[model samples]
Target chain A: MTPPRTPVLGRRSLLAAGAALPLLARPAIAQNSLKGTKLTILAGSWYVPENNTQLDQLAAEVSKDTGMEVRVERFAGDELGTKVASVIGTGRGADLGVGVEFDTYLYAPKLLDVTDLAEEIGKQYGGWFDVARAACMVDGRWKSLCIGQAPAAWNYRTDMFAAAGVDKFPDTFDELLVAAKKLHAKGTPIGMTLGHASGDARSTNYPVLWAFGGKEFEADGKTVAINSPETIAATEWYAECFKYMDPGVTAWLDPDNNQAFLAGKCSATINVNTIYLAARAAAPTDPVKKNIVENMNHGLWPKGPAGRYANYNINVWLPFAASPNPEGQKAFLRAWYSKNFLPNWTKTGQSYFIPTFAGFDAMDVWPDDPKLKIFRELNKLNRLAGYAGPPSPAAAEAVSKYVLVDMFAKACTGQMKPAEAVKWAERQYDQIAKKRRA
Target chain B: MSATTLPAAPARPRARRLASWLDNERTLGLLLVAPVVILLAALVAYPFFTAIRSALSDQTLADAGEFVGLDNFANLFQDDIYLRALRNTLVYTAASVVAKLVLGLALALLLNETFPFRRLVRAAVLLPWIVPTVLGTMAWLWMFNPNFSVLNWVLTNIFGLRGLPWLTDPALAMVSVITVNVWRGTPFLGITVLAALQSIPPDLYDASAIDGANKLQRFRYVTLPLVMPVLLTALVLSTIWTFSDFGVVYGLTQGGPMNATHVLATLAFRTGLTAGQIGEGAAISLTMLPLLLVLIVWQLRRIRRSAVA
Candidate 1:
């Protein structure tokens, strides 16, 4: 047993308090002293080399002000969910961790509700939440587990659009389809994805499914709504759109698919905006970006039967209750969210990702850029855009196994009908729903 | 008379002392092994307990329901989808093993030939196996895709046909996944078979040649018998690996074109991990334990019988 007359505290905190007694003493002890302090951030390739360099300088500054050190862990974004889930399931994860979109939804009972933290932070930052946290709520609790800029939706090659005689962005799915087919006929695949991978398939396909008025959940969100007629039409329509998608989509992960579009191989690709950096990186001298900045345009998602809805894959930094230093973690998060962290972090990625921070809207990260306006406007109205999360990555594997994936194969091969495929998914999901649920 | 005379000094004490000494030796041996035994027991307990508990309960991961005994398993039996997953697992195991063995042996024989850049060729063959399974499968997925697959491109444009969805068709998805396993697993099979092949004496082949034994006869007589034991071991390992494989199928097609590719292990993992139907997941995985035990027991008995013979 630890006998306690008084709690022993860190030298930093004790000194902070010791100085608090005298108003001048607090500022006298600088916060940026890197000694006796460490900050660990759980993130994906978010903090690139430049970001790290900036962060190092910031850490130096912070150490002088409050005596803290900072570091980052880079994981592949796609793998973050399962990795974090494993850690959280095992009852251990980082103090301040950024969770991917689907992972944010799959938080087990081991997680801490960041609702109060979100409210507290919201009070300080004033609407840092770019979207409603509705899709993130589980069983009546809010989750701040996700905070990404938004999903990439507008990808168009001005060079190709001009060559194809397209003047403005298509406002309807029908017009978009026509443009896509024209581009394809002109030998330009209009989009890209790795179709075999679920992440790619869902991101590229699910939006069209939703925008086309197909839903995986009923209106009340009480049951599976995937088998509806609209979903079938959506699937068929999507299958039609495949003609224009780049052939390499089957193997593409992330920005690569979009990178293909920006490479001038496709007229347009609905992909993450951060990938434009990769395209620039791949070939900075390419005439594509320069001309497109002058010619290409961005707009709200093309309308479909369900109206225009774009999927937003968000990432967030959430505090874990199991953290040994929850108070320290919370304090770090508070300091981390301030506008000071936003611009440097965004700038350091070399303009790789949009900032989810409120008031990042006016930042010159990409002002006057064609797609920034669309991204900003969409970011303002971002929604999880689904009654269900991506088939609960666990259930997704099972369903993909038992029905959906194989049925897609069959339907794509013309061995089965779209209705047959959806029916297969329903039947397979029923049994899968029973045996292995995640 | 001699016994009585010798025992007169102390027969009972000696026997008692000897017995005690023997007992101590036995206890010491057990004491030495106890930690390892306990460690193994602990290692296996959680999954066992989880499986047992889950098998009995009604799995309500999505809705969060009260425990329902035997319902999940009952549903397992009743549900054709899960039944299909089991069926696919069995098919995958049988096909993957046979394909790996045959393809591996053929490749091994080719590499066994004295050729230029033999080391380079051998290294190249093992590349897929060395590459992470998920990453390799992702490449395969790209190659098999209808829209972008180089495989489909070569098949359709070069041969003048149409694109085939290699990973989509129900039957073909199994073929695609099995083909990937074969591609990755063949290296393992080749190395094992090559080792076994290298063990045979040059003298045996010389003798067979001197006897006018044809190539076919020589292989059938000499190679088959010599490699059988090692082959069996390899077969068992590949069977287990293929049976439990999750990464390849998960990354490639995610068991799709409609669940036709799901194996038993993947099924259990998906249930327990994804659905949090902890109980059902446990049960699904547990179903394999008994069957695997039987196989292992059968192998052990065969090895014993061979030794005895």
Candidate 2:
């Protein structure tokens, strides 16, 4: 009679354990398959050291998740491009890494086709932005995964703007010019880098060029359209604005503007949130830095006659075709892009890296910081180096040669007239097109 | 006895042959020089030939391009940036070498005289040269910074004068880079010229004085002539180094202020490596060879002439 009363509690525990077996075995099988795999990732050292540390932590977590060993090596921003090119050429270094702007197009044939992974990421994260698609898709194939972009907004002094009778940041190019003149006359000029700076020079100049309806090439991507009236207008505007900016901006490298803004030598400059973040980090120990944190704010790029446009440096994740552990590389990227990881990574950047995923727009990354709100929608306004044209090798060459940047610089420095600068840029573009055709 | 001699005779013949070969002067010379020849082939010839081959092709970082001989060179002639770089290189080399020569000679002459702490002063003069080029360049960069320049602070605050745009202005950027180059390179010239000065017998100065030669007169006639060979060699070497100078300009200006300071080496790097146009970069580097070759040949002939005299 007692045997008839079965052990209900033991039976229930056994059934629950049986139900979880498949879920537990799935990971064990994956780990066994990738037990001996190793992946080496090369990333450019971020301006913020914390970003690099976060990447390292993520790599370690990924290594533990899948029984594959993962390593990340970082190099300076200037050297990263050369290192990536070397690895691609030799096919002996780095299984996966973050590549420079438009690298997908430059090294498309040598990259792994990650269309499936990219699509899955896009679907899971609402979708990829059009700019991301433009950057990573080459000839109808996804050559790389669009990671994020660093928006260089107008980092300015709020008190300085108010002191000059400007109650708010300029909303248009004309307003910006007036504000710049006022600020310069007050002895705190706005600085925009027009030197051969790899990042700031292009970020500022390209937006100005595109905002004025000037493009390096026509939509067809072959015909040179840089000598148009729109380009001439943009060059002329910059030349006039140059008179209001600090003359030292011509020599400003990537770091100069940040130094100038922090030193109070300039009232405003185009830069990433690093300036504001640096000020905040130092505020606790230094009274001057505290004052800077309270006074500084960031604004969207002023709208131009044609439209508002921004040229943030777009980065992508590149998996080399020659990677030995291809499966592990893809799996690591999957885990890295998962809901459990990417949101946390995005928050750590503090708007330094505005995620390209459309879904991330809903995520509360910059929760109590209103100063960083301007950068949230910056991805919507972004256009790559070759705006009207395809992001091809020729466009990349022109960009590397500083054709557009030089056009503005030549005019601003009074080395040439606006028309002459446009003409010179046109010739450079023509040469690039000819070479690409060859 | 015949059986034992037969076994040993073969070994003796081989040993005798080896010893005779070693005694041959021609064979010994060849054997001694073989290592150097192989080293040169591996280190110098291989890279040189690879650069030439790359220059001849339309290669890029991505693709191994087809042979497109002289096209990259032709493109350079048409490039305004290349033309500007050519002008900048000549200016940079000519200016740096001339400044280093004058300043270094003055330093060497001062060191030759017995002074308080002469050994200390002599060692101190080598500090710029001994410091790594990159580290020295970084210190100079801080000094030349637009906002935080100590030079500007002294000008505006201490001297009660307006601050100068040391690096922002195109002309001044060229001057700033040349200034750093001179600061770093003059010590090399000074140390070499000092060695050469020590080699000149002290009796020469006494002999010139006895002949009623004034100080300037003695320097022009005696010191100048004797120092000419070593000085010329130093000048030639300095010229080559300055012509191919990259670190100073790259570290300071990165050929900026509208490419005003872009020497050939920096421009080639930007065009070839940074732009991924490998062939064009190689072509830009090759442009330096011809000018350097002529300078070396002229210097070699002069050195030989001086030795014979």
Candidate 3:
């Protein structure tokens, strides 16, 4: 006002004010964005305390970065699917849910489309595995994200095998059966699942079926192929194998086999690495741990008649369509994929969670434990329940019904003859196919 | 006489209107219960009707099913597993209920005696009932494990008996599930019967004793008759609960040993939630209704007869 306003001073004042305005407004904008941000994820208690710890760590890191509160609710794997479905049916649930055999694709319309994120991840990790693609892809789009593969292996007692005079894990199903019978005579019968277990029944039974060349459905997806002669042979062979297994194998779920192995009751069992992880996590002085560490050995599923095929327990993470915080979900996915988070999570799992992405194959978690070397083949020689067909709703229904597993179980349990059980399962496949057709 | 009635007391319009309103008891009753009626219809009736409709269709978790008319029901009858489930459910409910009644009555009789720490004993007896079913079932599951089973150890080592396959063999799996159901349910039956036992007039027992009735005779005659109403009520309630029990079996055996233990509830769960055959599951669940209605009718008749007697 005084001395003929300096042009430079005016210009400087205007520029400074313009810059300061945005700076002053930035806090308000951030405050508004962060006002009530929150997200909830229904995580499976897949690996127990370790899975819980990793989830907490992930949540903490996510909260720190995004300023969004994250709530992780852990449910047992057996109950998680029903809980997720119940909440979904009511149109109320956490922002995201993870399921192993829940077949998230069955409820694709209720899930948020993660095509862009999934594609980006696929590009980053090379292409996804065929099983992963089958599990997550629906209607030509990715409906969920493949989290990990719970690779199944024969967690057998080396001492038992040695005592039974078996030099190695059998290379063929017949050899394995002979070894199992020898073990059974020794009073430590091999424990195999012949029940309605989502994981064990599928993991143990599917391979036997696939090896014997029994497909749940034909490639057409409409024709039921489970009652074929190949399946009948598989059933008869499995029934014989059942004789060498613990009588209770028919009632055992996924955890039973692990417990049986740990308790020194079973010579061998087909299971995820939870058995190994539990033994490893035990106190150094724990006898169970010592026994397992010293006696336990891992092997690939024995070659079946057709060839060896392993039932892959593929778990997927699905974001709900009703989720209000897609931003938070996206952010969490980004955090989950980071090197800082995934390797640690995989390590915490103790090989129970095999990274689906090939990029993480070099993680020290796998190489550190010699036992885990077996898991490297999990994705390589794996098949899901509906191998010949896509994981269609009908296939999902059949798997959920434990159609193939029941066929084996019924035969083993003497509830039905091998042929009758195969026929029974074929009828189930027909019903599911009919529903899908309708 | 008509004239003497004071010309019928010229009625005010207000009084006439009030009388008319009050005299219409049907409308008044409906108006009074409208809220509750509407609430019940919204809550109970709606879902029930929806389930019935869904059962007749070809619905999955994804699609709104088209009406396929008795197709779902037709499919259910052909399903051997469903037939097995129906049989298993009946066996489970019958075995569990009978076992619970016998054991619960024994427990009530034992607890009725005067002794030191009797209150503590009663409370301790309630522990199984008070502990959540799923948690209790989990403990039993551990105890039934083929390797670490405490029960097996007790039998094999202590009793010098061979280890029994508690949940492995088809016959044994049914036994194991029934045993567990009895374990969790007996306490409820005991506590309720105990309450009923206490409420019975002590004078009646004294009278029965005076009439030269022995302990068994007193129980057979006086105690039973007096406790019959409560016992029947408990039995009916227990039957319904046991018939529909899902958690215990699901948690323990999951209807396994080749579908030996699957009840209607687990079958429905397997069908609808697991198999995504929502329509078939609903049909399976609704199958419980006809039988359940029969039970309710039976219960009501018994209750009315008892009330009259």
Candidate 4:
């Protein structure tokens, strides 16, 4: 039979056999399967300029090191969740995602857990950075490694502080009130994105809870336990905290807060610190920008009885566990986590992007800068969920939707007494928890 | 001969004989329609039944949610935002339908008259309808920017009115969203009305004119009556569409400014995708189903009755 098929003895048959050999090994076939594979890195348009470029560089790095191809795609942050959901719902090409915080939490179950990859970051980056480490963990699993921290703290115009009167810094919440009043007397509004929009309130509101020693849950290092006594206080104080905000402050969200800060409409606002560098550059020539750039302070979150908690915000790059190469994904994490690689990456990102690894000297982010340097110094005291605890996404949503915020808004509007509002919020929060459990 | 008189044919047998008339044209028509009946049952009826069943079940994919009977529906009623969304959805639907009808009729009327560049103008009318919804919504958002907006720039810097937070301001956001939806939807209305307008006989309008009717009177009589059924169809379709619109609101307000602008579609999306409570979202969406069914059924009945009338 073999002799009858004499032509198969030629080099073409040998080549065919060689080609046919890999198809037989599922593992090898899976390996080769990813060679031409394209992974989408979805980013928001506001961040398109920086994020797309970084992702492109990452793809190049991955291609060079692992020879795996990748691509960077961008869309408006507003559209990312809906688009990703619709596509994924249709069983379409939703290969991977890099989303902002809300969408990340919203899509958690759908995402790949890159726990091992993040765990190995210690070997690469020489100990995961604490702030980054904390935020990236969920239920004690290192689902992601925080490549950067977007610590939300009260940024102020140091010039306004000087103009208002004496102030080194307000060390306590009470003192903050006095200082805030002085700024108001001097006619500078306090800024916050308390608007009911999804992103505006969630990212910026936690500090008020922390400052008031309130927490939805207890943090067992990384695990979040919802509903605690301190959380009630936090909710009550959150209402109080918004009292001094500028009129229509409830309408403000991240971009609105950014704009107010840019326009000098506010003496202080809490937000991610990424805008400092750009504000400085753009404000120099533009009067609006100048108001933001010169004489500003990226100070610590003002102290409450619980202590000043720079509410930590971090993002982790989680390669899917479903990746064809989990081991390869780990290798990629190792590359990302390398201590030597971080300075360049963080520097490229700029601002106080507290990198994941421990012992990273973040001073370089604001080395000589006056205001931003305060953030570098103060970032050490940053605590996760104000040290009371953090809420799982569902728990947080439960409390947020049913309780605290609505009462806080009422309290701020003077529609309800603060104490009455606090009690109402706590009761509502309890109901939300009970109902959700039910 | 009297005893031999044939007994009257049994009523049951006669009826059976009459019913066996499938060999007749009416039966042939029903036979011809049988494939469609089976097809519609397979495609539409089956899914419709399942969606209704799922709506009754409280189970969600996340919890591998266990069925809780009508518990989900009960919860849906308790939510204040859901109620607000329902109200907004109704308002939005009514507003959208009316706007589409009025704008569509106006455009159709304009296009009906002899005019220069008629073909170009007609093609241009379809531009908004043709552009993708997401893209069109985004373009509308750019125009609605609170600060640094071209619209605000014109209003504040040029016209000198104080700038309004078109999206961020709660008072204005809902109206702004409705405006954009109508802008995108009116073209479909116009195109349909124009098609309907073409179908109207020239003789009726000429007769109405000869009867001493003016443009408005002729439109009020001949034009209005002629196109009433088509307009009704368009209105019903647009109402259903606007009531469930997710993309425009998703792209524009995200049910924001304190969720004041949320409609049913956006609420469903936010709850399911953003909140990850798929069961709850499914529950919320099902609440809208009955309203849609009633509206559609009424329209169908009206369609049939009008045909007979």
Candidate 5:
């Protein structure tokens, strides 16, 4: 049976691979062999300043250790995706691209299989998450290495919740609704994007659907299962819940909520730690910044009808098949995954990059910070967009089209009724499934 | 004067060869235009034909798949979003074009008259045209922010008007996008119309006045008729530019509030670049080609007729 899209590579594959290739077997070629080779790695622009400095240091250290000159290039997330897509079939791009999602699946045929390297890393890091394995492994071969999974959670203002007579964050959907109404009455409102944002809409909305037991596809990952009573109920809930949100949330993009929360206009919002990190970047003595940091706190997504899940947009790094220096690229990947840099890198991420391996939990990155520790539990329950099924091309297509998020937005915005929105989404899911199967 | 012939003429070889070459007008003309012709074919024609080919195939960003033979176009007809995008493009272009023409003509008429600092005023009027489109669109994005919009502050505080959802509601989102397009595009029309206005002979206006015509009558008979040709050319070019506008709507709304503001260009970019459906994206964009061609042909014919008349 196919593995559920878990971040861990899975116990069965780990056990099978261990019997075949011993744990200590090093698949990496001689590092000194690529002394004169130069390769490039493409990544998204860093939201945190330390991330930028750390990457440069990492590249410099890699060059010093292996004598292979590694260069790093940065572009905005969407821009990087476009660049990768534009050069996919041309066999020319960065040797390795970081954080690419749907494009990784679309261009899987043009990526080098890193199954051996992945398994080796898994052995050292206490095994990969099943979702991470499902994301990178295509047709039973690993196409990319799961680098980081940014598990999204609810980041809210403590002061606002306290002022509304709520002492603790909500634990279920009903409680969240009640807290939101009280917070709205207190003048500050919650914000979960209900728009065509490039990232937030899909990342934040899918968990709400999952909370109500609405899966995009069945366990087989083949049948369309979105048109259900659960989805309709979720839609109706959004329609009412929207009344307590900022009126302008339907226009919010990825950065909009971050800006709103920082400006103190929002009581709560669903997002990763990027917003928290951005607030902390301000001068510590600054009253506004201090107030923001003191008032802000996070919670795991409220439990849904089925169970709890957070949207983990699992990011991966893949080596291009047409890379001129495969040995140099593989060496870079190994060095990047080393404990020497990985721990520091994870800390610099500031809870943004929750390590997929179990051993990473031992690192001080999450435990040291009071607020950051909560993220560990949140990331533990992270799931990919197609929660009940394996990550497939059809699932990726559904995400790219913003199918699930759009359904909720339509229902909440009065563009369509709950049932009608569900019907519309069903048709879209059918198309994606049919085209992918064909 | 007719048939007097000299008995003999001595011609140097180099001079005779030069004369022969200079006499070949057609060859020289072809040679002069060869560079431009080659450049156009390589840059414009090739990409256009490639778009057509891609539209007819199942090609994606990752792989160049087999030809699907009109399936992409057939699918677009059944796609609600594609139809909505097509409808948005037409509405956006038409609304923006008419507004630009009217406002541009008014500005041109005002600028044409001799006034204080006329030269400085003329230069300043081109500011919107001179500014980069992306930068201008970004500024507009901020101004249209739902919470802290300066426009909202002014409307509510100063003018006592209700707060407007500039980029949220479907009708208002379209209005916002079209308003920004007109703001940036009107300067192009103004400058072009101003040039045309200056070229009209002062004698024509005087002649109309002498024939017992008032200022309005003179403008209607002389200025309007004489400026018709240039105005039509500018209108056609502006229509093409506005129809393919990608950045303004993308920056301001991102075709959001449920894709209400998406035009063919944004839809195509989303489908091909973002969604990885290169073939379908190509089909959506190429649909604009035939419509634009027909518009250009019709407008050019009007310009030619006005010029001849």
Candidate 6:
């Protein structure tokens, strides 16, 4: 009696409009809010050049969609950390950038909190991996968006393994030692960097440490537990293994193993998929590359006495707290995580950038290539640099200092006994902890 | 009116007075030097003071940090890596300077001789110094590559010897880095010493020869004394440069194979920038000041004493 009956067409129109609300409203709001604003991103130059081109395209697309000026600056991977640190300290620089490892924790206080954005992306992507959360979440807040991990596995030559009388890559460290000796005798020795290389050195050595039940810290993330018997055992094992490896492993920087493996100088080495991808890329032109492409396969990191583990370098997208246009930065991240952008970017990496989302594990990218299949499970066993401890600045400092790598290197090189090496690393950890406490 | 009138003294214009003032020696000298003083203040003094302040404090890359006085310095000694880096710096600098002086003096003496395309040879000698340190070091890096080293290839294939671990063994890495330092640095000393060698009067050599001095004696008596001052100067400069060298070690080895080659500069960079401990890094750098000061002071004293003699 009080109101006239609403028309069927009108109710239908209202329902449709309500359903279309977000689709219509989001872009308009984002466009207007960010109009005339600018977004600058600083990223480490990717090993795959196409990844950089794809990111640039993404920035261009985001700019066009939001009417914001967007720019991306690329630097060498090693230099990006220092640049980001400067940006955080000065409260100026790029609005958004890529941070390596647990840099989110290293600069957490000055990083923009993106909990809502992270949750939204996670919900859409079937949730982030535990490693991603461990890398980016600080104090229960998402401080950065984990882009993906560059899984470091043993990229081996199958023919060499066969020639050495090993049918497959070794499954355990003990077996790996025996295989290494045979491979050495066969003149195709295994190589893992024991140098100060930020990527390969830590990636290989940390797993060995963890596999032997040694950790840099107790679970409390504060105590120095590196001087334990497990560490000495790990060191001793590494020293014996060192006897059979290429003598140059200790001097290898991040790129040396890739060069050695590609040149057929080493039978097996711990590295990311870049070496395989590179070989495949060169196969058509170079017969040697073609041969390498055919003979090479990726293997899981050898299991240790404790357990199998990995320390893949995790890359994340961090927005600075000093960003003048926080909303615009968040919008760009949203667009970045969208299906249109992320899938293409992930594909461009050719599994080198294993997406941090668990949903990506089922994606066609991993299964399509047999060599990359090893990477699908790599994230599961992956641990942050400071195993059994929070990814704190102290741990990052220890990593930058190359403590664990040096500990193994010293024992391997006979600079110190395994026990002394363990003690040396323990003292380093103690000093780092003491400084952090102060 | 004509008889009583005296010419009124001309009043000088303000612009003319200013021009005269500017023309004065003291004012002109100061004006010429002002920009340089300002530049040094901005580029050097300010940063130097800031570094000192940082060294005194607990500054990190992320935190402004509070002053902890000498705690950072005290802790540096306790840190084995820092101690190792200190020792490396000494050994690296000493070895490099000594090698460079010998090689550079020999190169200068060779270049000073009458030879075909002498100018061309001198220019070619400068190629190492002219090439950027990073680029040249990268070439050396390849030469020292463990698997594909051309140096090793030559050693194994031609000499029928085992390939040495040029960059792998701790002792070898130190040697490799020092070799690079001497390689790059010798040219600088050579060029500098050659200029001094050319300036020495030919009559002095003739006079020494006429006095029955042999070629060796002539060099020992006449040439040595003449080039000694210049050689000392070159040695001082080379010592400073080698002591603070970051590029050669960083490029070739990056203080690796167990920190066998970490000089002060690379260690400071690793600690301060890479590790984000700005204060400790600054402290490490500041430790260089006293050593450098002693060196500079001794150099000046020697120069003064020689001049007086």
Query: Could you tell me the lDDT of residue A69 within candidate 3?
Result: 86
What's the C-alpha lDDT at position A5 in model 6? Answer: 19
Give the alpha carbon lDDT tens digit for every residue of A1-438 in model 4.
000111112223323433443311124323354565555554454331443454455556555544456555666654666556554444354455554343344445545576665655465445665665555665566655565665566677888888989366677777777787787778785666666544446556666666666665445323233244555566555555565666556555457677767767778877666556667656646776666666676656667777666545455564443445554554444444443344545655544455555556532433345555555555576554324544345444543252444555655656566666566555544444444567
Candidate 1 chain A vs. true chain A: TM-score? 0.76
Better of 1 and 5 by lDDT: 5
For each of the candidates, the C-alpha root-mean-square deviation to the true structure, in angstroms, is 8.6, 7.1, 9.8, 11.6, 7.4, 7.6
lDDT, candidate 5, residue A68?
A: 81
DockQ of every model listed? 0.20, 0.62, 0.52, 0.20, 0.50, 0.62
Return whichever of 1 and 3 wins on DockQ. 3
lDDT for each residue of candidate 3 in B52-128, tens digit (9 for 90 to 100): 99999977776676998998888888887889899998899999999999999899988888999999999999988
Q: What local distance difference test score does each model get?
A: 0.61, 0.85, 0.79, 0.62, 0.81, 0.86
- As a whole number from 0 to 100, the lDDT of residue A106 in candidate 1 is 49
Best by the lDDT measure: 6
Candidate 6 residue pairs in backbone clash: none
- For candidate 5, what is the DockQ? 0.50
Give interface RMSD, every candidate, in order.
Answer: 5.5, 1.1, 1.7, 3.8, 1.5, 1.1
Error of 3 at A107 (Å): 0.6
The superposed Cα distance between candidate 1 and the true structure at residue A325, in angstroms, equals: 1.6
* DockQ-based CAPRI category assigned to the predicted complex of candidate 5: medium
lDDT of 1 by residue, A128-202 (tens): 563535534556565553345545566676667767777777888888888878788788767635344444445
Q: In model 5, which regions exceed 4 Å deviation?
A: A1-32, A64-67, A283-285, B1-29, B299-309
Return the candidate ranking by lDDT, descending.
6, 2, 5, 3, 4, 1
lDDT of 5 by residue, B61-141 (tens): 777878989988888887777788899999999999999999999999999999999999999989888899889998888
The residue-by-residue lDDT of candidate 2 on B39-78, one tens digit each, is 9999999989988999999888777888998999999999
lDDT of 6 by residue, A1-438 (tens): 011111122223322432443322354335688899999999988877767777777677667767899999888856788788789878888899898766787778888889988887898778998889999999999999999998888999999999999998889988999999999999999998998887898888999999999999888888888998999999999999999988789999989999999989999999988898888878888899999989999999888889899888888999999999898888778767766557667776767889888787666555366677677777788899787888887888899889999999999989899999999999999999998887
lDDT of 1 by residue, B1-309 (tens): 577688566878888987887689777788789998888778887657755775777543323335677776677777665787789888988998998989888887788779999989988888878999988988886787544678877877899987765764567778888999888899998988888888889899999999999999998998889988888888887888888788887776555544667777777766666545556776787777766887788778878988999
